[model samples]
Target: MKFFKTSLLLFSTLLILFSCRTEEIQIIDPPIENELAANSTVAKLMKNTVAKDGSKDNIIDKASCLSVKLPVTVTVNSKEITVNDEDGYEEIEDIFDLFDNDVDAIVISYPIEVILSDYTVKTVNSDEELQRLAENCTGENEADDDIECLDFYYPLKASVFNANLELILTITIEDDEQMHKLIEDLEDYSAVTIEFPFKVILNGDTYVYINNMQELEEALEAAKNSCDEDDDNDYNDDDCDKCSTEGIKKIFANCNEWSVEKLYLNEEYLTEEFKMFTFSFRENGSIKIDNNGDISEGIWEITGEGNEMSFSINIPDYPAFNGTWYLHEVKEDSGEVSVHLLLEGNHLRFKSQCSTVKDGLNAILLAEGSIWAVESYKNTGEDETAVFADYQIYFYSENVVKAKKDGAVIEGVWESLNDGSMLALNFSDEPVNAFNKEWEVAVMSETEVVLEANDKRLVIKRIN
Candidate 1:
């Protein structure tokens, strides 16, 4: 009986050892690539997305891979200025514009701090030290490590799991810094699965939905070097990164009564002739032009994609405006929409007067007790602003204008024509008569109204 009991005990121990080995095999069976391993390609791409972008401050430092810390003192064109923030860069630009003939230079004060691409901050005591650091950066507009065309949407939840696929903990990633740290802290025995159906923005305007890790990886790889990073020191060179064909189509189809605000053909301005016409674009690729009760029909189409979009219009009556013009920019400011098109030396801008924008401008113009003073005026390319220095103009809701000077008032009939694109004034008085005619509303705001005619420009500012 003792020998039989020993044999049974040994068999039971072997059974237990076999069970332990099976479980160990299961734990180590998961492939490292399936998890958020430290050396995984996905992890590396995520790190690149979160890496610090020092090119934003290239305007001040003239370095693409480094940024000067804020509140640094610098001499801009012999004028000492303290750059407190990004707005200070514009101030420096203004100083640089003060004189165009002179050489522009910026001298940085010593002992200033700079941030590297990896977000490392270091203090440089002299110009030589800063130059040495800048020498390590990529050349202007050259290829760089950081991916500028793609960005992950924030507040993403990551589901963490152990090697056995058991839920460990969930992490919330808010911004780039949090994401960077999360990817950096990934362990070999753990897996991080980003919750599916997350969004990423491409070129700051296009939205892409990612369903799984594979899609995310593919998107990151595709967008790594898909655009111009704008790493050059020319801050004013606006890249149309956000411009897309679909966006331009939506803007054109949605808004009616688009008037030509500016039109140039081979360096000749032709805006005055098109002032009387209003354009309407249809989604079915049809266009209608209304010229003071006269209607003309045409077909329009947009070709290409993204920033390479081109607009082609064939208006049989107006051949000058017909061309496959490159879409330069589409901008909206304070309810106003403007589309800029360029081809060779030709430039055209279409300003839309949507109902909301027109109503807003009319409200500002007809506001009770509002008075506008002539800030500047030009007649036939000659400055005649001083003639109306004492005049204060008022607009009534009933399309009546009254110019008061020295307690004497001159009545004039006024109208907002071309869907608020033009301001027509019929003042018979001598000084204010110079403002008569259909003036294009080049700019309209709460505090100012700028009108332009053929060789005549007028600027009026609101006083009260």
Candidate 2:
């Protein structure tokens, strides 16, 4: 009986000990594949996207893969000048443009520093050193490894986590250099998570929102080689980099008139023939071509976006001017705006005068009781001032023009054209038939108007 009692006590003690023992816990970690690997394709693409674009200073170095540090002195055509920044490149171009017949050359003041494709700065002590470095670069306009079509908006936040999924560091990247360093310093064992909701710019203008890593990788891959990087020695090649279809359309619609400043069709210069033509673009996709008082209708549209945009015009009557022209550059200088278009060997330039100047000229011509008398007149180098010595010309606000001498009156129509750069006079009177021509306004004011046509000149002074 004592043996049985002892056995029961042992069994109960064993049960209690087994029940009090701790459970064996397996600490399974989260999958490492869920984290971004430093050597992944997306990380490599990001590094390439942020790589230094040395082609921006190609004008100075003539090397598309490296750039000379600025504030360097250069002898352009024997004229010494310090190029402080990118704007100083224009100064070098101006020197070269001073004489087209001379051999244009630029000599960089040596011991100048150069930045390479990897963002490494090197000292170039002589022309030989620069040439050696330049020889390592890709040929002009050739393909390079750097991705220029995609750019990330900075101040990007990224969190670095250790192997245990504990946050080791959080960094704010401010620029391309900072982002490049971050990608270069990443370790395979560590994971980095980019904060969501950032912006990326494609081809310099298209903005895209990136919500996650997958979207960012896809965007960067798609943007690769999407457009021309303008990796060339020509500084003016990328002048329209910031141009957009909507912006070009706005420029066309806002301008009152555009005159043909230059026109080349298949290597033939036709600028003179179209000088009197003025173009007006409406928001409804209709275009008007006004040559003096004769008007023609056409359909116009801008297609594509960003720098790849094209301007297409279809004028049934004007076949020579109908084509889908590539929008090259839109330049605004002083008070004039110029839109340059190109197609193969053909080129076209449209210029517009300032609106303020056009308005001032219109106000002077439509003034109340304005009587203009002939001050001088020359027809084909022959003095013809006596032909209208007794005539007094009257300009009406309704575009009616009348010239009265003794008792006879000559009726004519006058209109201000070419953004006030020209005056068109249409007269059926036999006595003043010579005046029925589009006259280029050489000078205009409240008191005097000077007109020129071929070799003929006419000057009229406001007498009232």
Candidate with maximal TM-score: 2
Clashing pairs in 2: none
Over 1-464, each residue of candidate 1 has an lDDT whose tens digit, in order, gives 01112245643543442221122222233233445556678789878877877777777777888899889899988889899987687557645644448888988888899988777799989988888999998888887778888988877876545546655445567778767766765653256566666778777544566766788889999989888788888855653567766767767755766999878786578999998899998889999999999999998998777578889989998998999988766666545677777777577778975534455567779887899999999887788888999999999988899999999999998987755667899987887887889987766778888787877889999999
CA deviation > 4 Å runs, candidate 1: 1-34, 162-166, 187-189, 239-464
TM-score of 1: 0.47
Kindly list the per-residue Cα lDDT of model 2 for residues 222-326, writing each as its tens digit: 878898888888866645778877777777765868999878786578999999998898889998999889999999898877668888989887777789988
lDDT of 1: 0.75
Error of 1 at 405 (Å): 65
After superposition, the stretches of candidate 2 with alpha carbons farther than 4 Å from their true spots are 1-35, 236-464
The weakest ten consecutive residues by lDDT in model 1 span 18-27
**Error at 214, model 1, angstroms:** 1.1
In model 2, what lDDT does residue 415 have?
A: 87
Cα error of candidate 1 at position 350, Å: 16
